[model samples]
Target: MWNGDGTVEIDGFRVYYSEVECVRRIFERHPETAVNVRPKNQLVKNAYMNNLLDLIDIACLAPQELTEEELRDAENTLLDLVGVDFELDWLKKKLDELCVKKTKMETRGDCMRELDRMIVEQRQVLLALEVELKNEENEAVSDSARLGFEDVV
Candidate 1:
């Protein structure tokens, strides 16, 4: 089933079956995966994570169905996924918490100074990303202008 917001609400087992069937169909019809358009990395990552979670569920509920090797592989893959970097919002939230902690410290020791240095460095990185995004937008606008109205349409 699909929600109004364009998100699916399917069981993990159903997801695994559906994805397997889809892959089967694709392999049967078009083995070569050459295409002009490709899914975004984020979307691919979400699907991979979903499949991994489904595997974990199966391992929990029906351990004998999967081989020990498969279980070990899945566990290692999950750990690798878990080690991915935190999202921007989460990083910002943790940074704010660190700032509060540093402020609450009574003395300006090496720990407090290191926290301050890290906070400043992270702020600089954020600012640089913002500047890069603005630069990209400006470049797009200039590219469109150079292409002329007819080409844009």
Candidate 2:
């Protein structure tokens, strides 16, 4: 028997069921879903995405003998579990917006690092100029002290 949750049990020979494998199985079952099939590293690293995939997968388990009421109930269960309105176009738009925001944040971080580097270099140049000015003042004072005057009172 298959639990429809990516786990099957029949003759005691079963495969390990994990969230990553569950997502892969969902893709295998519902080849028509238009969402991007993320890589294994992404599915394993993001808990929210994995659970969302699980919710999206619930529809693939439609029983072979579902009546109208059972089908409606199953649909409601999927909606309640995921909390998404399930509009394919709207979801795709949102995904694109998120990718744009991530890129902007990375660019801002790089700009901030460059600004910090410029500030440090300017401070070093100012320090060298101040040391040179101090040495010129000391030389002028020593030259004045060595000037000799006539031997008159």
Candidate 3:
């Protein structure tokens, strides 16, 4: 029996709540249900799906703000859920990949900041050099004119 509110029931076993809440409640109430309800490796996938649904609810309720940690957790959950082969080794591999990707992204961001700083510094140096060159040219022209006047006299 479908409750039309993101919940369903079958033969008296009913999970009545939103997606995430229902799953969490069901897991809490019947730990064994985790094995029967979904593949062990896919647990993270189920959690991620629920979290995504919850995020939608959060967005509708409060669109103004969301914490970075919450967003990151959701992303991590999704990544963990993908390509699960129902094996412990596969699960560990997925986690490792996620960690590596996160580290690489952080490093790339740092490099970009350093590059920007270098560009700004270069621009300042170039401007200073241009000013110096202009001053030197002006001095040269003035000296040339003074020498010409002396020669004429």
C-alpha lDDT score of every prediction, in listed order: 0.49, 0.49, 0.52
Top TM-score model: 3
lDDT of candidate 2?
Answer: 0.49
What lDDT score goes with residue 144 in model 1? 72
True-structure RMSD, every candidate: 26.7, 15.9, 9.3
For residues 9-62, could you state the per-residue lDDT of candidate 3 as single tens digits? 432334445443555654565454324333433335445445534533443332
- The regions of model 3 sitting more than 4 angstroms off are 3-6, 10-99, 146-152
Worst 10 residues of 2 by lDDT: 7-16
Residue 153 displacement in candidate 1 (angstroms): 99
Give the number of the best model, judged by lDDT.
3
* Order of the predicted models by lDDT, top scorer first: 3, 1, 2
By TM-score: ranked, best first? 3, 2, 1
Residue 136 of candidate 1: its Cα lDDT? 100
